[model samples]
Target: MSNDHRRLGRELDLFDSDPLVGAGLPLWLPGGAAARHEVESYLYELERRAGYQHVYSPALGKRRMYEMSGHWHNFADDMFPPMRIGDDELVLRPSMCPHHALIFKARGRSYRDLPLRIAELGQMYRAERSGVLGGLSRVRSIALNDAHIFCPEDQASAEVAGVLRLMREAHEALGMGEVSYQLSLRGPGGKYGGDDASWVRSEELLRGALSKAKISYADARGEAAFYGPKIDVLVADPAGRSWAMSTIQIDYHQPERFNLEFAGADGRRHRPVMVHRSLAGSMERLFGHLIEVHAGAFPVWYSPVQLAVLPVGADQDDAASSFAADALAAGLRAESVHDGSIGARIRDAAGRKIPYIGMIGSREAPDGLVALRLRDGRQLDPMPQAEAIALIASIAAARSQELLP
Candidate 1:
């Protein structure tokens, strides 16, 4: 088995640690940035299609927000120390729920907005212990694919089901098929925010939703959040280790604590139920998991450099440049490396685990053909550039790792 940290980042030139910036933070190298952008774009597109209105909130907030959300009491230990801005204390946001609640409060809500889904690709900060920091998994600063749905109590089940469907769709799109779900509940004597009846009712609703969906899940009795029970999606690595990647949670207490209310059809004020779900719990953790799961061999869609064009010599530079430009314009990520022999160039591309490698030498240049080498060690005879580009694009859009014929 491979040591978890040895697979990617450095090997693929994705990212590295900077002592000057402190531990638990990552400086994304060019390759790593590209991979992150691809994942972010995927999430943005998915959420957009699911009717979520994307928004951005500040990374830091007044201390009163956390106190109102009860995070100050329960999660203070994981929070960074507050900064003194005059008499007010400003703390880095460890989570975006409180901010989102403020947004709902700012706009007078009604039953007409019952199922409002707000999303953000939020950057969050947490104070993780130094020892637990490794690559991108346990980072201090991370991006979260976070969304919250505010619905009437009666609409709770449907909203939870909707979030689950979105999560499943995202996982399938990303080629993560072996994911498992866990329903985490509050333990005895846990410092939860709501009453016994409230907790029980919300838990039942969540359970029913998961059951109706026919999703296989495990139950964790003592692992719930202070304010709610949650359904966590766990993705296993190639080495058989499970990582928590997505979460769907029900919060009945926060709206009450924040005094969040909406007018019902009966013309009565009632508290709205809140569902906090993250398809990718945090980009940092997801990237780290992807590195281990793929063993640095990212699929075509997520690979930093999908293809590399290697010309035999300086004389072939023009052809290599032309090929790289054509591929780039066609929405295929490609680069040209013309300083090395054909064999060395191929080895370099292989080392990077690039999905495709094209060799342009004198023999193939005249006929407008390029020899294609796939990651799985298969070679195709000289093929037209358009066919190769189309083939690569199809593989990327479908997120297929297998080589094209």
Candidate 2:
């Protein structure tokens, strides 16, 4: 059987939840938060480089907006009840695209600004059933890697393709191998919000984009959102269980309902197509998946504490502390321990799966050198402190999983 994330999460001290905090809500500890920060930073930089304008959208919105977006009618059961205060029914937003659509509607646009991509690490809430609540995988409060692209009808395919490329590259960088795609389309009847013509156009555009990208995808009928069709990326765990990781959805109904318009070359107002994409479906769930996939042996770049310094005795404490301080200053996650026996400290560090460990004793502490220990049970005797720091820092900077020489 594969490792369970809940068990590994406790052992690694990554995250936890209390009954007082309500079910399905997790509080990230410092170490866990550090790892999550790296993930978020990586995604943020990638999206920024790809011309995504990051924004902060409010977590709460008026019920009137969801009503207009048709989420109230289509997804009300999964949504939190509206909070009525001062004659305003405020709702914890279950999705961010509706708010993103409103943002586009707030400003008039010309053809020059057609493919405006607005991205956010948006906060969303859902009313999950108590019986199903467990770890981060099934959370009520979620941080989503959400983005919406408002583009012209002709540019929709290109936009969807761009998002697909982002998803593929991100998975590759994270070593999430062999992802499968599913193109979700509407079924029959009035369950779908948009007209048949609009749905067909959006579905065809997504299909063409996948075809142009040379990606094979299964057509999933009746799996689409009420507003539009979408493409879902599925990744398998070590045990071969598949989990949905990313989604690229094209919405025609919301754009129309919001009266979102852009001026075209013909000098007339036309509705802009909206594409909603989430590269890391949800932060909490992705982290949970990563915990199980990597089995708490995160790559150097993702490890909360990459190096642990263990001193042989109290006499060598200064050297160990100095080395650790220097490593931390060099932007490496490093820590020093002198409270227990050298063997005990190393054992603890190894148990935590720290990538590297430094052993300082009487002989090496005097010469400002330390013995290096690899997580794989290899060791180097009496290397210069500066050399070890530089090598480990370099490997970490490169984001490689390889052990240092």
Candidate 3:
């Protein structure tokens, strides 16, 4: 296993999980939070463009709610111990499906609202074993990049296709390599929540969608949730290690279990099917994998500190600060460090895997330029301030993994 993430995370000042704050609960430092903010922003825009409306729910909920959704009974061992509050047992939510289902049930729906795509970067808590807790990859508290699509049975497959497209686009953008699919179906004679017909229909719907989407998959019997069948997207890291990072599940049971109803074309009530998706899976785990995949050298747009300004001498300190300010105004994350020698500053920034470094000195300051250094050891000698800022800004705007030529 790559233990480099821990060292890299510390060197980058990314995140920390203090025993005082409770194990498996990571505290995102400023640097880590900056990266997370960018991730969340990108996902919000992506999901919105795909017709997903965002929603919010409490982090903890009454146990009765989970009981109704069957999560309390099916996965109780994975949940935190309940706390009594005003005649109700409340626990931290291990998933967001129950809350979202309740939201769908809050008001009567029509066929027009058949495909309501609800999304949230919801916080969840799981009681992971202490021995298995390793940084952000395995955490008790996580922010799931989760969504639920409620549609009629006829529309479920089409909705799933849209989700598959989103998944492909996201993985490509993040540069995740080839993804394999696992179609998890119920085993023969296993006790499932829904009727046999519903289970068979749900399985066919998911399989049909995957086929329509032209995604080849392997069948995994007995790998499904109690409520339904699902497709798990597996991605391999740079080291050829695979992780189940994304999922799409077709669920007929939850809607029926909750008695969720919608009006059909004939003006009769019908149960809407629920398709669950988590494109990036847990944000924490995805972030952890990203940290390892990039080997701490995040892409320019995703880097917490996009540019670092170092002053070669005391005379250039003020100029360095001004240069950093200019870069920041240009929508670049830039900072000036004058406390150490230029060599030391550069080394520190490089250790943190900063993408670009700018050295200001008496020579460069007089010409109003900076000696630019790329992380890969390339140098641009004394480039004009405007040109440097423009280069960095345009590359960031492109979200390119490579440096501007």
Candidate rank order under TM-score: 1, 2, 3
Taking all chains together, each candidate's TM-score versus the true structure is 0.96, 0.96, 0.95
Can you tell me which runs of candidate 2 are displaced by over 4 Å? 188-190, 238-241
lDDT of 1 by residue, 1-405 (tens): 463643567878888887999998888889989988998999999889988999999999999989999999988999999999999999999999999998988888889987889999999998999988767777999889999999998899998998889888877666655788999998887778988888898899999999999988899988998999999999776567677889989998889889998888899998999999999788878887777767788889989999899887777789889989999999988999877567887888998989999888888887777888899899898898778888899989887656663
Q: What's model 2's TM-score?
A: 0.96
Q: Which stretches of candidate 3 lie over 4 Å from their true place?
A: 1-3, 188-191, 236-241
Pairs that clash in candidate 3:
none
lDDT, candidate 2, residue 109? 94
Among all windows of ten consecutive residues in candidate 3, which has the lowest summed lDDT?
1-10
Q: Model 2 over residues 70-156: C-alpha lDDT tens digits?
A: 999999988999999999999999999888988888888999987899999989999999987668778899999999999988899
Screening candidate 1 with a backbone cut-off below 3 angstroms (N, C-alpha, C), the clashing residue pairs are: none
Provide the lDDT at 314 for model 3. 95
Model 2, residue 55: distance off in Å is: 0.5
Point out the higher-scoring one by lDDT: 1 or 2.
Answer: 2
Worst 10 residues of 1 by lDDT: 1-10
